[model samples]
Target: MKIGLYFGTFNPIHVGHLTIANHLAEHSDLDQVWFIVTPQSPFKKKSTLLDDHQRLEMVYRATKDYVKLRPSDIEFGLKQPNYTIDTLTYLFEKFPEHEFALIMGEDNLKSFHKWKNYELILENHSIYVYPRLSKGNVETQFSNHPKIFNISAPIMELSSTFIRKEIKAGRNVRPMLSDNVWHYIDEMNFYR
Candidate 1:
């Protein structure tokens, strides 16, 4: 199977995330897109992040209806300060029969070289990059590489940070989240 791993903290899965995943599943060569929920990212501050299980549950609630998209807790069992290279290596070893790729925004490609073993990732797997509205033009040295594909997926200016801020301010975020997720957030009083 050809699986595209869409890795993110997913503090709360929003419609923007769903739209990108759905677009990738429908437009790309990938058979499935797995939203690999990261418990913690080495590059991000943890103070603003929700609990790992809460984020994971929100991802599950948002993506449960899509057959082509799956919510993955693969990083939950792995060590904290998870690195993409280590996760990819582990996945390759565990699922030798399946082919894996990475799905990311063009903004990530701008700093791709900063990632650990980035060259190895490019050599072993493909990357499907979608545009992000806030990101400027990507000027990567690896632009010509065959494994890197630039896809024209819809760009949403929305972000999880904005959603969280809205919730904390007692503003409605219904349009930004799935119905299930919105209800859950309200019932659980999340981000408030």
Candidate 2:
């Protein structure tokens, strides 16, 4: 299976996340897109961030309806402050038959070179980058790299920070979230 790993904190999975994952699954050569729920970094504490399971639950609910999109809690089992390279290595070892690729935005692509063992990742896995209205230009080395594919997916401007703030301010941001995710957050009274 060819899987695209869409990694994120997903404080509360929202529609923008679903849209992009679905787009990549349907438009690209990838057979499936996994929303990899990134575990919270123990060093950078944030009270707003939900527990790993809570975030994973939101992801599960948001992606349950999609045939090609699925949720993964793989990172939760790994050591804290894990890097993408670490997760990729683990996945390859655990699922040897599957080919794993990365799904990221142009903003992340700009700093891809800074990642630990980024060269190794580039050599092993393909990177699917979607457009983002970010300020910096991507590094020249990645411009024509065969492993780095610039997918013309929809640019998702929505952010979890903005959604959390809206929920805290008593705004109805229901439309921004998947129905089940919205219900879960509302029931838990998260962010409010």
Candidate 3:
């Protein structure tokens, strides 16, 4: 089975995220897209992030209605920083019957070189890259390797940071996030 592994902190799963996953499911060769919730990443600043379990719960609530998108906590058992290479390796060993592809954004493309065993990641897993609004006009900016891909995905101006800021400011985030996720956030008093 072809699985698209979408790795993220998913502080609060948003509509933009669901749109990309849905697009990948509909357009790509993959049979399923797993939203792999990272506990933490060395590259990210953790102060602004929600609790890992809460984030994962939000992802689950957001995606529970979608059959094609699966929420995973694989990184919960893995090492800190949650590198893609290690997760892929563990998945391969655990489920030899399945194959996974990485789903990433163009901005992250620049950080590709910083990942652990990046070449090995390229050699083993396929990456489905969606264009980022900030990647500029330069195409294939991180094309040192042939495995890097470019695909057309809806680039929404929205972001988790923006949504969080809105929530902090007592602004309605209903239009930005899924109803289920938004309700959960309110019920739990998240981002306060």
Candidate 4:
């Protein structure tokens, strides 16, 4: 089976995120798309992250009913400084039968070179990149790289960052997140 690994903090999973997963699962070659909840991303600021298990539960609640979409805790068992290359390497060794691909936004593509062992990742796995419009995000050539494939998935203005800010301000985030997830967020007081 072909699987696409969509890694993120997912402070609180939302509709925009689900849409991307659904789009990939239905439209792409992927049989399933696992939303790997990263406990701590080496590239991101630690102050901005929610509790590890809490975030994971939110991800779980968000994707509970989607057959083609699932949540994973692979990074939770791994050591700190959750790097993509290391996670991918571990996944390769553990799930050899499944074809794995990296699913990331164009925003991440611009900073690909800064990642640890970026060349090794591009050299081995096929990367599925979705378009994004973050400031200063530029397009680069991945076709020249044999294992990368540039794809345009549904892009959204709703982001985990925006959702968090809304919650902190005591604003209604029901519109930002899925119904089930928003209920979980309210019950758990996630991001509060």
Candidate 5:
């Protein structure tokens, strides 16, 4: 099986995230796209993030109906400041029979070289990059790379940070989030 891993904190799972996953699963060579919910990203600020379990539950609620899109808690058990290289190595060891690929936005690709063991990641795994709004075209170095494939997924300007701000301001964020996720957030009074 060729699984594409889409990693994020998912502070609250939103439609943009789901859309990317759906597009990758449908349009790419991947058999499935797993939403690897990171408890805390090394590059992101931890102050604004929700509790790990809460974020995980939101992911579960949002992805419950999609067979091709599954929510993963693989990073939950791992230590803080999870690194992509370490996660990929662990996944490779545990699921030797399955082929793993990385799913990310073109914006992330711009900073790809800064990631830990990025060269190894490019050599060992395939990467499916979706277009992101506001990000410029792919750089020449990675434009024609064999392991990096550019996908035409819709560019949603929506973001988790924006949604959080809306919720905190008591605004309706229904359009930004999945039905169940919105309901869960409303019921829990999250981000308030």
Candidate 6:
């Protein structure tokens, strides 16, 4: 099976995430889009993120209804401050039968060169990029790369950071999240 790895902290697993993942799963050649919950990302600060299990629960709830979308806690057991290259390598060895691709935003692609062994990752796995409203230009090398596919998915401006801020300010950002995720956050009083 061709699996698209949508890696993120998924602090709350909002609807915008679901939309993009589902779009790629249904429209692209990928059979399944796995939401790999990152315990700690090398690029992100851990201070703002919720507990690993809490975030994973939200992801599980949000993706439960979608056959093509699934939640994974693969990174939780991996080394801290994990890099994409390391994860990809581990995944390839662990799931030799399944073909894995990367699912990321245009914003991430802009800084792709800085990632650990990005060239190696490009050589082995295909990348599926969704549109994101971010600044800066993409590297020329990646512009017409055969392995990189620019998916014409919806440009999701909604961000987990924005949702967290809204919740902290006592604002109802219910529409931004799935009902189950919203209720989970509400019950746990997270980000408040």
Clashes of each: 0, 0, 0, 0, 0, 0
Best by lDDT: 6
TM-score of each: 0.97, 0.95, 0.94, 0.93, 0.96, 0.97
Find the 10 residues in a row with the least total lDDT in model 4. Answer: 136-145
Once all C-alphas are superposed, what RMSD does model 3 give against the true structure?
1.6
Residue 38 CA displacement from its true place in model 3, Å: 0.6
Candidate 3 lDDT tens digits, 1-192: 999999998887899999999999988888999999988888788887898899999999999998999999999989787778889999999999999899998878777878889889988888988877783555454675566667788886678988888999999989999999999999999987
lDDT of 3: 0.87
Tell how far residue 56 is off in model 1, in angstroms. Answer: 0.9
For candidate 4, lDDT tens digit of each residue in 1-192?
999999998987789889888898998898999999998887788788878888888888888889999999999999898788889889999999998889988777877888899988877788887777677526565546667666777777688888888888999989878888888888877677
Q: Write the per-residue lDDT of candidate 6 for residues 75-94, one digit (tens) a residue.
A: 88889989989888899999
* Model 4 global lDDT (CA atoms, 0 to 1): 0.84
Task: Give lDDT tens digits, candidate 2, residues 98-191.
Answer: 9999999988787788888999999999999998877666556798999999999888999998999999899999999989999999999999
Q: Please provide the root mean square deviation of candidate 5 (C-alpha atoms, Å).
A: 1.1
Residue 152, candidate 4: Cα error in Å is 3.1
Quantify all predictions' global Cα lDDT against the true fold: 0.91, 0.90, 0.87, 0.84, 0.90, 0.93
lDDT of 5 by residue, 3-62 (tens): 999999998889999998998999888999999999889888888888888998999999
> Alpha-carbon error at 179 in model 2, in Å?
0.5
Number of residue pairs clashing in candidate 5, backbone atoms closer than 3 angstroms, sequence gap of 3 or more or interchain: 0
Instruction: For candidate 5, give the lDDT.
Output: 0.90
State the TM-score for model 6: 0.97
Pairs that collide in candidate 3 are none
Weakest lDDT window of 10 consecutive positions for candidate 3: 135-144
lDDT (Cα, 0-100) at 185 in candidate 1: 89
